[model samples]
Target: MSDLRDLYQELILDHTKRPRNFGQLATANRKAEGFNPLCGDRVTVHLELDGDTVREIHFEGSGCAISTASASLMTEAIKGLRVEDARALFEQVHKLVTGASGPNGGGPSLGKLVVLAGVRDYPIRVKCASLPWHTLCAALSGGDETVTTE
Candidate 1:
């Protein structure tokens, strides 16, 4: 499993060094901002919907490598999905990172997101890694401006 661990590390580093969909949508239908005070990670997710489908998704923020990369990958994952599907993704990802249902509960299927699972071993980093997903949930939930750990 050492090889797999290295692979996961590489994946996380890649996402951090070169984030995907890291920008802002000119006309976003939905938007949300999240802050992880534990690690001082902050981010904003913006989405443009085209007939219930996310035609565009983007992000702008400053955070740890894990947080930034997570947001970057999140934008890519949810771009083509509907709002509801995106919401489901948020819950799925939340459980994945928190190990709420135990290891491999739902994280292994999260693609690059699974790389972040190692973060569970580090309690403080858990909030860092989860920042993006929290922002996403807030963005999609509507009628909410903030979703915090506090």
Candidate 2:
């Protein structure tokens, strides 16, 4: 378990220093901004949907390691998935970060996002980590306003 935690930590740090898909999507058709007022983490999620499939996804923002990594991993996870699948993935990730004891013996089946499971231990940091996800939700729903984790 300690080794797994270490790997998670390393993965988070790696994403923090160099997040994946960390830029604006010039061709994005959907976009939403997110902010975690408690932790001051801000993020913007951009998506390009072709029919029901996510043709592309991207994000730009400034926040803690968990926030950045969550956004990065989210892009990787949701690409090529249908809108419904993306929403399901979002729910899975939300459950993971919210400390829900999932089927994997308390660990959610979020794949790379499992690294963020530890964030639940830090209540405040959970907001930081979830900011981008909520933004993604808003973007999917065609929301134009900024989403806030109040």
Per-model C-alpha lDDT, please? 0.78, 0.84
lDDT (Cα, tens digit) per residue for candidate 1, span 1-150: 875463348778788899888888888888888987666678988878788788888998898877887888888788889888888888887787777858665745566666667777666677877888888877776645866656
| True-structure lDDT of candidate 2 | 0.84
Compared with the true structure, model 1 gives a TM-score of 0.86
For residues 52-89, could you state the per-residue lDDT of candidate 2 as single tens digits? 98899999989877789889988998989999988988
Q: Which ten residues in a row have the lowest lDDT in candidate 1?
A: 2-11
- Maximum-lDDT candidate: 2
- Look at candidate 1 and give me any clashing residue pairs: none
User: Each prediction's TM-score against the native?
Assistant: 0.86, 0.90
> What's the number of clashes in each of the models?
0, 0
**Stretches of model 2 off by over 4 angstroms after superposition:** 1-8, 103-109
